[model samples]
Each structure stands twice: as structure tokens, then as C-alpha cells.
Target: MWEETSAVDKYGASPTGESFEPGRQRQVCTRYKRKGKRHRRQTGGATRTVMALDSLPSRVVLLYDEWLKLADPRTEDWPLMASPIAQTLIVIAYIYFVTTLGPRLMENRKPFDLKNTMVVYNFSIVGFSIYMIYEYLMSGWANGYSYGCDLVDYSSNPLAVRMAWTCWLYYFSKFIEMLDTIFFVLRKKTSQVTFLHVFHHSIMPFTWWFGVKFSAGGMGTFHAMLNCCVHVLMYSYYAVCAMGPAYQKYLWWKKYMTTIQLVQFVMVTVHIGQFIFMKDCPYKFPVLLYIVGLYGLIFLVLFLNFWYHAYTKGKRLPKVAQKSKALQNGNGVHHSNGVAKEATNGIFYGTTNKVANGFHHGNGIHNKEK
Candidate 1:
């Protein structure tokens, strides 16, 4: 019976003895299971997962549009809140607690195992950035808006929830950046926290808050793109450095990191200025320009001062040493020519050989190679 079963279906088998399952039948459909048809689910967070483009419900899109209008009401109708002074103080206090107090508590603690943490963090942020980059690219070609528009109206699109989630993550990163200082404060590497250090830490998160708050137009994206790229390199450098001394020399790009930061500000200022000047595009302009302009000027001044103090002074110190070296090479010793000539001329012939010997002795060049 078992042998016969191999040769027959419920009805019968082909003459060649080919058989099929009794419940099975031939189907000619060419389509394979589509990628998202099953087991596809929301990811990232509740707001992000359910509201994703793949499974976005119509109601969510409507709600998102409503939210965008609320978030970015027309320029004239914005309700006045606290004065800038009050708001600024509140924001500064908030940063002091989040960036400073938290880090101080963790001071004297061993550096966190940044390797594993950074790996997970980078992978997630990089994936999120890639998603946004793709969204921007497609939106540019097919959706009519370019990079800036994508960012400004980002909250209104179907995928706005995901962008919001990622934007929040980037905002939180500024807080994480405070750890750069904590490591300084803790490790007793106080020299690292120069004025540039505190200024960068203190200002950036606030800049981002206003950026997201005001809808900062689309021109703000150059800031995001440059930041993402810098973080990619910066965190990777940190990850490698955490491994050991092997990476110290490999970090020659540290110099370039500062350069990149300066360049990022320049581009940001120019982009914001263009929006302010042109008075074009989907999002508001002059508002972002004013905010970015102030921030950019602060950064420019602080960073240029830092560059001068760190590198310019550094270069000058070496040049000073080189000049000293040249002077030493000109004379065998550091003694003045007058002292040498007086001593030698008074003691010796006061002529050709005496002067020559005096000069050689003064220069500290014992050898006759010169």
C-alpha cells in the first residue's frame, strides 16, 4: 500500500508514475509573495510604526496635516509666549541640568562601554538617516520639493512620524555630546573643555530646538546632513579610539573635523541667508535666517578663536622653536659673539684664528663642518 501511494494521487497517477498531493493542484500565478503582505509591522516606536508609509491609514495623514498647521501657523498669527529672555534662561537652565548636571553625576565613573552603545546607536541613527536621505531624494525628483522642503514640511507628510522620531533622536544626541565634556571633567582632562567646548555644547541643542520649533524652513537640512556625516566619522573615531592606543595616529582627521564644522556653519549661514533674501519656497524663511544667523555668527567667532588659539598658536610655538634652532645652528653654543670674541681676543692673538675660534665656540659648533 505504501509503495502504491507514491504512484497515485486521490484519483490517479500519470503513466510515468508522477504523483501529487491529493489536496494540491497546479497554479500558474507568476507573482511571488510580496515583501510587505505578511509579517510586516510597525517599527521604531508606536507613533512611527503604525504611521509608517507602508501601512499609513488615511486618518493618520489627515491628523498629520492638521498637526503641521498647528505646529507651523502662518507667520503673522503666531501667539506670543514668554519673552526671549525668559525663554532663553529656561533653555539654558534645561541644558545646564541635562548636559552638565547629568555628566557631573557620572564624573569619576569609568567611561561607559561606548563600543557596544555606539555600535547600536550608530546603526540605528545611520539607518534612520538613510531613510530620510532616500525620502528626500525621491521627494526631490517626483515630489517637486527639494532638500529644504522635505525637512520643513517633514511633519506633514505621511512619513512625518518617522522623521519626527529621528529628529528627536538627533536632538537627544546633543545631550549625548555633553558626555564629551563629562569625559573631560571626570578624567581630569579639564584642558579639553575650552570656551569653544562649552559654547558648542550649550548652543547646539538650543539651536535644534528652535529649528524644529519654528519649522526653520528647508535650508536647515545642510546642518542635518553635515551633522550626520560628521557624527558618522566622529563616533567611528571614538569607537576606534576606545579600542586603544592603536587608533591615536589614525585620528589625524581630528584637524579636519574642526574644519568640517566650520564649513558646516558657513553652508548653513549661506543657505539660511538665501532663503531670507530670496523669500521663496514652501516654508517660512526670515525667521530661520535670524535664528541661524545669530547661531552661525556665534559659532564662527568661537571656532575661529579656537582655531587660532589651538592651531595657530600651536604652529607659532613650533616656528619659534625652529628659529631658536636656526640661531643655535648659526653658532655652536648659545653665547653671544661679543662675549666670545672679547674673551678669546683678550686671551689669544686677537686676530683671524682667534676670531674664527671664538665664533665657532660661541655658536656651539665643536665640529669644523661649517
Candidate 2:
């Protein structure tokens, strides 16, 4: 039953008729003033914007002032609090071994047919994504999120702890997903193991560990949720493809998969971009938002590059094919209207044959020799 007016004006009392101590009221009021002053300083002279709640829905502002104000994520008893560094080193070693050593090891040996294993692995990831989506909705969005400046809940409250656990589970899933490139090497689909692929799989968990460590839930979790949704689609595609040849028809729309990926990055970038423009969010960790936003942009650019090569440049003849074509043409390859064609036809070349044997036997030309 808190009111928006209470945020700035009625700080000396609560809705339940409890009176705040005069000294406590003064301290809280001073903090509010300092927040405004800091906003004005950091926002590049939008003093009017110093009162950030004015731009937000009153209900949301009230929610922030009442229940969300009690969040405390700094307790020392969190799980997996000690293993991040070791896990990161393991990830680094995994990357090095996969890109360099694994490919070499795979070079001489026959590629293993991991078709059945891949089907199982990819679908399991899809199921994990489904669980994450449910956890995110239940623990964060279901709580009536402002979707604006929602901050993490650090309390031992059951729902809050659930959100934290979901965040960690999402992080751990990325580690499991590193097997993507390992599978590629095993199958000798080494061509599929590109820089963009490894960087995406490896760096994701490494950076997300920080998200789980500090702010496990909030506006920040939105992209994580969206990414999990996209992974559901992505891994499902891989699973279907691994079911042998019968499923190939189902993959006719595979060309649009990269389009879908680009869209995901765009969504993430926009979601995180809100933190930069908003005058104030309930969240204090502005740096985390910047990191998330930059991560979105970086991946967006990398995926665009992949799409350009995979679709645009991929349409052309490969290097060896183009070389053979140029050799056959003699004068060089010719391109017109995006289609390659031979520069010369054979009828003209036969004009220099001295009309002998009717310009070569079996050509069906008639010339009498006396």
C-alpha cells in the first residue's frame, strides 16, 4: 500500500502507521538528496532528471521503495563462491587444447560418427534452456518486474535464492556447452569450429560467472533469459539435423538460423542499453550493465561477420574452383549480373583451324581435300 508520494515526501513514516526515528529519517533523506546530486553530476546536467522516479510508473517506484529496498547480495555463505578461478583456468585449457591440440590429434585418425551422441547432447541443452526460462519467469519476471531498473534480491527469501540458483545454473550450462567445438573436432567438422564459435562458447561462461557472483538477478537477467530461449531453438536445430538424413527436409529454413541469431543479439543490446540512458535504476551496478551491453554489441558484430561470409561470400565458387575456372577461361574469369560466365565460346576458336578435317573430326563440318 505504499504510494509514489512516499518515496520523496513521506520518508519519515511507513504505510502501516509506524513512525521512523527522527535521526533515521534524516539519514534516509540525506541519501536521497545525494542520489539526486550524483545523478545530476553523472547525467551530464539533466538536473530535472535528478528525480528519476518521475519518469517511471508510480507503482514501480513504490515497489522499489518498499519491498526491493531490502535486497542484500553480499552475504558470505553463497555456493560455488570459490571455484570460479579454477573453472576459468580449466576453460582456458579447454580452448587451447581444442583449437590446437585436438584438431592435430584428429588429423590422422578417422573421424568418429557421433551422430547419436550429438542428438542426445543438443536436446539435453534444449531441455536445460527450458528449465532456465521457467526459473527466470518464476523468480524474477513473475514478481511484477518494472522491466526498467529492477535490482537483484540478495535476501535469503526463497524466491530470491531461487533466482540466484537459476543464474548459477545458467552459468554452468555454458561450461557444458563448451563441448560444442570438441564435438566438431571429433567429427572432423573442423571447418565448423571457427573463431566466432569458440569465443562465444568459452567466453560466455567466464563472463557470466561475474554476473552470478555479484548481481544474480535484475534487469541484467533479461538478456540471459532471452539467450536461453534462443539456445532452445538453436540446439533443437542441431538435434534435428543429427537424426540422420530423413530430418534434412525439416532444415530447409536453416538459412534463416543466422538471421535469428542476429536478432537475438539486437534484442540483448537494446535490453542492456536501457541502463545507460535511464537517470536512475534501483540497481547500483551500472558497470555491469555496460559490460553486458558491450558483450551484446561484440557478439552482434561477430555474428554479422559470420553471416556475411557464410551467406554472401559463400555463394561464390570456392578458391580452388575459381582457380580452375580462370585457368580454363585463359583470359580470366568474367562476372556479369552476379553470375560467372566464360569470356569466349568455342566456335570462334575453330575459325583459326585452317578448316582441316572439317575443323576436327566428329564436329560435322564438310571440307573437301584433294
Candidate 3:
């Protein structure tokens, strides 16, 4: 019994050696119970944190669904308007090609001779632009559209339906225009693929998706109509250019194209700005009014800067003068006529001339000719 007590005092075990005294056992159980409770709390906290993390994607999906609910039910079923994913992927692929893969692939390759292809493409766009213009006019712009306070005709009226259809066509045209950059890349006119160029091409379709989905006609259609008109002129210039050097004389109004573009943005800005002063302009989605106004103002500033640099700053030299300067600089050796010895070589002359005239101008736009 004394040995047993001694063991209990030394090792905290009872006489059976398998258990502790009741008081000590209670303390040990309490300690383990406390640890178990703490572990359970920690596990519960971790589970909740995991649950919150798992809910993030669900939350995003819910928000997207809510946003979709705001879209025009009529247009929600239209091609490319059903989801933003298609246009988004298209823009991404476009950027990746023009900026990255396309340039790298062309690094060691001769520029493709695409003059014939370009002519066809440009004129095709001209024809398409004309079609869109007529549609815009017939549907609204000419069909009793009050340019001052036109609101989106969200009805099943033949005219309204026609306008919506026209707007979708316009949106699709933006994708078609992206081929412009692809042509530039193919022809090795990478210098023509400026930030303004890519941005204009990519943003148009993406934004127009929303436009067609929400406000397909009315005040918004004005810019689309005006843009189509400008494109008719712009693509016509490009088509003429693709016809060869004999047609160079017809491009005298090259600088004026930029002027025209500037005018377009100005008119767009002014037209959209009228909403700010009008009272009770029941224009559904006043948000779009602000967006169009801002878009116009931003492009106006960008094109203005382009004009200032390309024309006002005297960066664009006359063709003859440019050719003459290029010839003199070609080989650093000028003949008595002030032409480089290499000027006799058609290849050298053409290359140097192109280099001399490759100035940035036009619709974020056309080729180096601008």
C-alpha cells in the first residue's frame, strides 16, 4: 500500500498503475477537453474561410447574371450580343497576332505583295460602308429621325427592327476592319499598325456590342452613320492607292482625310453633347449619352494631336520633295542633279521613297500614305 501511494505521488498513477488519482485525472481530462475545443474552433474557422473562398466564383457569376438582366431582351438573342466572350476573345487574338506573333513571323520574311488583295479589300469595305450608310438613313437618320433628341426605338416596328439589324451589321463591320491590321502585318507595313489603329479596331466591336444590345438607334446611330460616311472616303482613298503609282496624283486630298476625321469626331461630340441641356430627354439609358459624349471628346483630342503632329508640325513633306530628299540621302553620294547614284536602281529608289514618306497620320488608320 505504501509503495502504491509512493508510485501515485511520484508518477501521478493510482495503485492499478493504469489510472491517475480522481482529482489529477479530472485535471488531465479537462486539459484535453480544452485542447479539443480549441482544435474544433480552429477547424471551424478554417472551414468558414474555405467556404468564403469557394464562394468567390459563384459571386462573380451572380453579378454577371444580374448585369445580363439589364440588357435589352430584344437584342440579347442577337449574334455576338448573347455573350461578351466571343468579342473579347476576338479582340485578344487580334492583339496577340498583330503585336506579337505576326511581327515575329515576318522578321525574316519578304513583305507579301498584297496590292491586288488590298484593292479588293478596300473597295469591298467601301461597298459595305455604303450599304450601312443607306441602312442607317432609311431606318432612322432619314426616316423621321430628329437628330437633336433621337431616342432608341426599342420596338418591333419595321423601321426599328431595320435599325437594330443595321446596328448589328455595323458592329460586325468592326470585326471585318480588323483585317486591315492583318493586311498590314502581311505586307510588312508593321509601322502602320499603331496603338491608335489597334485600339480603334478592337474597341469598336466590343463597345458596339453593348450599343446594339442597349441602344441600337437614335442619338447613338449618328456616329455610326458619320463613321460609315468617313469610311467611304477613307477606303476609297486606300483603293485608289492600291491601283499603283499612276494613281498617286488622285491622292492630293490625303491630308484632308484627317481633317474629315477630325470633323467627324467634332460633330459626334457636339451632337451627343446636346443631351446635357435638354430637359426631360426621355432617352432610355442616359448613361449611353454620357459614354458617347466621352468617346467623341476623347477621339477628338487624339485625332487633333495626330493632326498637329502630322500636318501642323510640317512632318508630312510633299511627295516630290520627299522623293528628292530620299534620293540624296540614299547612298550619301549625290550626282550633279542632286540624285543619289543608286537612284537609277528602281528598287533602291522605291525603298528610300517609302521610308521618307512613312509618316503617321489618318484614322489610327489607313496606311503610311496618310
Candidate 4:
């Protein structure tokens, strides 16, 4: 990578031996020697001659110095970087609208057919999640990261800067994912916005701001990477679901999706648990790690409960539907194939039993008795 310099002046150089500008060459060498001393004095430990030439590392070094001076001023003046309080308020507003006000507004109205919209949104999220995973890995984790006791790297190293960018992108994605609940509202799929779902979506962005602002590179980042991996699968599932009802036949993996999610949260918990056992890691931000760990535990418990109700407990009919079924017999019966003995229990519970009718009902599915 050295830049070659000729001793001869291009304007005039005698053949072979004697140089016409020997005095000028001597002066140039002296100036270079003085500059070298200054560079050494200023650089101190940053005497990484090779490292200084790399594009990303050089840019990171420049930006980090700039960042130090503007950290406080730029933060106050900036939009998203203002303060944690502002972010918290935004989250609170989001929660109040989606769970409370938005649902109420949609109460009397028919559900909007947001199939196309949901398809686009979910797939977009899947793409973003995958990109984040790549950045997190290539940026730092795939490098010298210990994944056990690694601390936040504040240096302007290329890997560190890339990691910071990924963390910021991850934080921003949380904001975008707020649309998940909003879509549920628009489509009147309010039931999908469970307590766990609401809490997860609402809390992520607010908490992640702290992560991006401070510890963007370190042991704390493993969960975010894992979460991104899970989201690639998770959002892909939702995208397929949004394609239409015809796709339901291909959705036999729905049960396994929940299982995968449970596994994701468990991994998060275990990864964060390393902090507790490590004898000497100078990770200054244990608060975030604790929060991340507790958050994982909370969701694990919630997902477990959801799995129990969804799969293990079997389906239970509602009181109103049960009473109505008990009182009725052949009232709404339509006998084309045979007989449609029962009314539908929403879309989830299709036909249950069939006598002459082409249907069978076990758990709230419409059925015909022989």
C-alpha cells in the first residue's frame, strides 16, 4: 500500500547519477520526518497504520470523535434521540390507542379486508429482520465476540460501528412492528392482540432505545440476533396467513410455530443468564441485561400458558354457544350432502360431525349425528 515517490524532478532530471534538485529532495525528507513525529505523538495507541486505511474503521474513528462532542447537544435536538421519557410517552400513547380506543372505534364497523396490506407488511418485516440478523453477525458476533463475557466496545472499530448500526436498526424495527397490533385492530382481529402480544410490541422500542444509545455491541446483543432469526420465520408465517383463507390448508405448522416461539424465549433467558455466572465481566449495563432476561422469562411463562390453552387443554365451547346448541336440533339443518346439524363456531371451529352431511364436529366443529 505504499505510495512510491521518485527522487528526480519530472521537469528536469539528468541521465543516471546526478540529480538537479538534490537540495529540494533533502528539504522534502526533513518535512516528512517532522510530520511523522507529530503523527506518532497524536496517535498514541492508535498507531494502527493498516487499520487506519480501512474504509469502515477510518469512518468509524472520525464519527466517534464527532459523536463525543455532539452526544448531549445532538441528543436533545434530535427527534428520536431526545430522551427515554419521550420514547416512553410515545409507547404509552400507542398502547392507549390500540388496546382501548382503536378497538372501541372499530366495534360497530365491519372488519376491513386487510389481506393484501397484511401480506405486504409481514413480508417487509421478514426482510428487515433477516437484514438485521446479517448485520448483527457480520458486524460483531461473527468476529471476536465471546458471547459469554464480552463487554460493550466503544472503540471506533469497523465491527463495533456496524454493530451499532444494526442495534439502531433493530430498535427502529420495533417501532415498525407496532403496526402488528394496529393491523389486528383494522381487521377486527382484536383477540390476536393478547396481553403478551401487546406487552411485547409496546415495550420493545422503548427499551431498545437504551440499548442502541449505550450498549449496541456486546454479550447483550445475542438475544436480539436470535429474536431476529425467530422473526424471519414468524413473520413469514404471518405473511402466508395473510395471503388468504385458501392458504390455511398449508398452515399445518401453526402448532409448531408456537413451539418454536417458546424455544426462542427460552434461549433468550439462557443467554442473558450468563451475566449472573460470569466472574469478571465489566459490562457496565447490567440493568439492560436484567431487563432483557426478565422480559424473556415473562414471555416464556405467557407463551407456556398460551400453549396449554391452545393445544393441551383441548377446545371448550362458550356458554352461549353451548346453551344454544343444547336447545336446538333440526332448526337450521340444511341437508344437501346429508345434514348440517350445527351452526359454525366462528372460522376456527369448522364442521365437526357428519351423519349424511359431509362434516364432522369434535371440538365445536359443526357435526351431523348418524
Candidate 5:
């Protein structure tokens, strides 16, 4: 017994010769209990965090539902205005094609000869623009519109309904105009697909969706009408270019198109700006007026920049013309190759080449290579 007691003391017995196993076991159990309590607290916190995260999506969906309720009931059943998803998808697909897939596909493929198609397409847009212009004029601008503080006629009046239809048609025309980019891709004129080009094309339809959805006809239609007028001249120019080089004489007014675009934005900005000073204009959606005004201002700045770089800097001249000018100056420096190389650099870099090769402007105008 003494030997066994000695062995126990050597291992874990207290100095008083008492075995420490029971006390040690108690300490170990206490440590485990404390650990278990801490684990429970951590697990509870984790569960709460997970639950909050799970509810986030539900909250977002609820917010979206509330937003949709604010949309115009009249346009709720319209084709693309019913939901934003269709238009969003269309814009996404357009970006993808023009930026990535279209270019890669056309890498090895030859450019399509679309002269005839372009002629028909341009003329069709001209005709459509004419029709829209007439509708806009008769419906409001010419009928009895004050041209300032014109409210949306939501009533079922014949002219109001006609304006609404015209607005929808105008909205739809934005999508149709997207084909301009598609043609560029198909023709392997990918160089014309500048950020401005794609951004303008994509953003127009998306923004117009809301415009037509909320305020179909009113002062909102002013820009649309002006845009159609611009399109009339722009597409007619494109149609003439598609006809052949024999008709080049008709294009002497090409630079004026940019001027006209600048004028259009100026008018839009001034026209939409009227709402700011008006006392009691009951435009159903005053928010849209501000948006259109800002839009006009932004495009006005962009086009002014374009005009400065394109015309003021003498970059709007044709390559052949530029080379001839260089030759005539006795500079003995041939810039045709250099200009060509610079034009391929990027947007706004060698804008002359861009403007020369029928670059599509954001305002739906195309300048064919001279």
C-alpha cells in the first residue's frame, strides 16, 4: 500500500499526499462547460446574422414592388413597358454583340455589302420620322400647344390618344435605330462602334421606356419631335450616300448636320428649361422635365465638344482632302497613312477618319466616307 501511494504521489498527488485526479477532473469539466457556453453564444449570433442576410433579398423585392406601383397604369400593359426586364435584356445583348461577339465573329468573315439595304432602311426611317413629326405637330404642337408648360393629355381625347401612340412609336423607333449599330457590325465597320455610339443607342431606349411609360405626351414630346426632324435630314443624307458616289454633290452640307445637331440640343435644353420658371404648370410628371432638360444639356456639351474637335481643329476634312491640303501646303508630308493610323486609334482621337467613314453620331446621323 505504501509503494502504491508513493507511485500515485509521483504522478499527480498533492504535496499533502492526496490524489489530485478528482479536482483536476472538476477543472477540466468546468473548462469544457465554459467553452460550450461560448460556442452557443457564437452559434446564436451566427444564426441571427444568417437570418438577416436571408431577409435582404425579400426586402429588395418588396421595394421593387413598391416602385412598380408608381408606374403609369395606362402603360402597364404595353409591350416592353410592362416590365423593365425585356428592355434591360435587349440593351445587354446589344452591348455584348457590338463589343465582343460581333467583332469576334466578323474577325474572319467578310463585310456585308449592304448599300441597297441601307438605302431602303434610311428612307424608311425618313418616312417614319415624317409620320411622327406630322402626328406630333397635329396632336399638340400645331393644334393648340403653347410650346411651354404643355401638360400630358391623359384623357381619351382623339388627339391625346394620337400623341400617346406617336410617343410609343417614337420610343419603338429607338430600338429600330439600334440596327444602325448592327449594320456597322455586319458591314465589319466595327471602328464606328465608339462608346458614344453604343452608349447613346443603348441608353435612349432604356430611358425612353420610362418617358413613354409615365409621361407619354406633353412637353416631353418636344425633344422627340425635334429628334425626328433631325432624323429626317440625317437619314436623307444617309440615303443619298447609299445611292452612290455620283450623288456626292448632295452631301456638301455634311458639316451642317453637326451644326443642326448642336441646334437641336440647344432648342431641347431651352424648351425643357421653361418648366423651371413656370408657376403652376400641372405637368403630371415634373420629374421628367428636369431629366429631359439635363439630357439636353449633356448632349449639348458632348456635341459642342464633337464640333470643336471635328470641325474647329480641321479634323472633319476627308483623308484625301487632308492629304491634298498637306501637298498643297508644300509640307511634302503625306498624312493619309498617318491620318488613317490615327483614326484607328480610338474615339475622339482621329475623329476625322471616324466622321469620314460614315461614323454614326449619337443623334442617329451617319457620315459616309467621302
Candidate 6:
């Protein structure tokens, strides 16, 4: 049996009977057998050989091509006269114009409500976020950059046009984000539009511009990937809150959101550090180093300040309690529905006096009449 098996090969053809050496015969027979097995698969062609264009939705490819034309930033007829520095300056000027002009124009109007428009807006942001994550996870495993940041290093692995379209959507979303401040101004929520908010909003569009410009396929895809995940949760929370009472408790992890943002910055910094310290890397590091450094410091300061104000200082509000007591006494309890009342303390105080007084009115609230 062993002699027969050795004499025969992957193909039914007897190797010893063939003119070629048994090893060479076996190699050819194995290949022939493999091809025959592949033909049995339900799909016709090898998946890797399939063109992405064949599977891509027609509208997406069209839009992607259009966006490429607009966003390419490469042209001899209209050459890039100014460096990225000029573009950065232009963005700064635009920020200044909006910050100054927007307030005055919107002064009379009420702040924008997160009710109807915010729901749509957040849904869109989160939807794009999901697409970004999907693309990132898919490409990361396949050994390719998800976003256009791949040019920083050449990837032998090919990506689909759909992946390219998804990345373009992520890129354009940065432009649409300018409306975040517009909404803030319309609602007279200018106080919320801090320098951190404006600066972040301003820089990101240009940062992504350069991201696509220099490193059109590389480690930077992780930045978009991470941001998308964060935005998914963040905007979903916003959308839920906008829906009135539907899912108000959905964002129970609001405190942790800031922590996650801080962690993201730390991770980005560390990743950029690797690029800087490494002796051998395929990417150009100087540009990425500047971006990562600037981004890290800015986010660290902004996040720490936000954490302090939102949690730390907020916890130390005995002064607010004292003021509440003062206002309570100053209002003076009144009789209503056969009951009396007394003064109390802060925001967290109870309605004990309301129970005694039967019905009472204070601080824009009406208690039940006894």
C-alpha cells in the first residue's frame, strides 16, 4: 500500500509512470488538485481578485470621485501658493471672524435647542462614526490603513473603493462640524463655546486636510477610528437627550466620557512617541510629531480644566447650599391649604416644609396644597 501511495500522487496519474521525477510530478499534481477544489466553491473567482468597483454602490463612487477632485489639493493651474501654514492662518482668521461676528448677530436670538435639529445632527455624526469604525477594523486586520493616512507607509494590502468613500465621508464631516458652534451661538450658549471648543473645532479640519495630504494611508487611521467610536457614544447620548424623556438615562456614563477622551489623548501621544523614538520607520515623523504634540498639550489642558469644573469644583459647592438657605428664609414661608412652612438649604434639599404647609410657592415651584 505504501509503495502504491508513493507511486501514485495527488492526481490519479501514477507518478512513477510519468516522464517527470516523482517530486516534480507531485508538485504539478498538487496544483492541479488545488485548482479543481477551488472550482467547487460557490463563488467563481478568488475573493482577492474581485474588483471593489463591481461591489461598490454607484452613488458612493460618484461622490468619492467628486470629493477627490475638490479635496485633492494638487493642481498646477492653481498651485498651492501658500504652505499649510497659510491654510492654518486662514482657518484662524475664519475662527476669529465667526467668534466675533456670530455673537453680535445672534445676541437677540435664543440659544439653539438640542430638540429636533440636534437629533438629526447627532444621528448623522454617529452613523458616520459607525462606518469609520467598521472600515478601520476591517482594514486593520487586512494589514492596510483604513483612512487616507496610509501614504505615510506603503501598504501592500489593497483596500476597496467603499473604504475610500467611507474615509472621505469622515473627512467631510470635519467641515460640517463647524455648525456645532453655529448651534451654540444660535441658542445663546456662547458660554459653552470656550477657546478649547473653538480651537479644537478650527484645527481639526486643517489637521485632517494635512492628514490626507501627506500621510494618505498610515497609522493616523487609528485617530479617525478612535474618534468615531467616541463620537458614536457621544452623539447617541446627545440624540437620546434630545428626544425628551425617551432615554435620558442612556448617558449615565457622562463622567467617564471625559476620562475616555483623556485616555485617547494619552494613547495618541504614546503612539506618536513611538514614531519619534524609533530608529527605523517608513513614515516622515516631523509633521506628525508637531501635530501630536500640539494636540496632546491642548487636549490635556482642556480636559483637565473641564474635569475640574464639571466634577471637582462642582463637588465643593457648600456656598450654593448656603445661598439656597438664605433665599429660602428671605422668601419667608407662607400659609396655604391649612399648613405652615419653614426655611431650608440647597438644591438637594427636600420638600419637608411643603408637607407641613399643605401647599406652598417658592423659587419658581408650587407645592401641593394640603
Best candidate (score: lDDT): 5
- CA lDDT, every model vs. true structure: 0.45, 0.64, 0.73, 0.65, 0.75, 0.53
- Give the residue spans of candidate 6 off by over 4 A: 1-97, 110-114, 141-167, 305-314, 317-370
Model 4 CA lDDT for position 70? 36
Which regions of candidate 1 deviate over 4 angstroms? 1-144, 147-151, 154-156, 159-165, 194-196, 279-282, 305-314, 318-370
* Tens-digit lDDT string for candidate 1 (1-370): 2232233444545447665444442220111122222323332355575567556677776786575564543221322221124436644765574456755766666644444554455345445555544543343423454534334654456444334434545555666556555444444434334454466567766766655555533555455655565555545544544444454555555436556656766766666566655544555544665776667666656556545644576422233334455565465323221112112111111111111101111101110100
- Candidate 5 Cα outliers beyond 4 Å, as residue runs: 1-44, 282-284, 309-366
Tell me how far the alpha carbon of residue 192 in candidate 2 is from the true structure, in angstroms, after superposition: 2.8
lDDT by residue (282-311, candidate 3, tens digit) is 887888778878988977886776555444
Q: Judging by TM-score against the true structure, name the best candidate.
A: 3
**Tens digits of per-residue lDDT for model 5 on 1-370?**
2222234343566555666686574564566667777877999999999999999999999998897776666767878888889999999999999999999999999988888998899899999999999999999999999998888887778888888888889999999988988888988877667776788889888778888887889898899999899888878877777777677666677646667878999999999998889999988778888888888997788667756655577655546446566464364223332332223222333323223234334373333442
How does candidate 6 fare on TM-score? 0.56
Candidate 1 Cα lDDT to native? 0.45
TM-score of each: 0.48, 0.63, 0.80, 0.63, 0.77, 0.56
- Evaluated at residue 169, the lDDT of candidate 3 is 95
Error of 4 at 285 (Å): 0.9
Lowest summed lDDT window (length 10), candidate 5: 337-346
**Total clashing residue pairs per candidate?**
7, 0, 0, 10, 1, 14
Off by over 4 Å in 3: 1-17, 309-328, 331-362
Q: Report the C-alpha lDDT of model 6 over 1-370, residue by residue, as the tens digit.
A: 2243245555545644655565676675576666666664634455533655566677686885675553323311222222355556757765865688888877777655545887788688778788778876775624554332333433323563334444555666766766666666666655545564566667776776655554444565556667677777766655665666546445455445557667776666666556656565556535755675567655556556544543577432234344455465465443322122321221111122222111111111121211
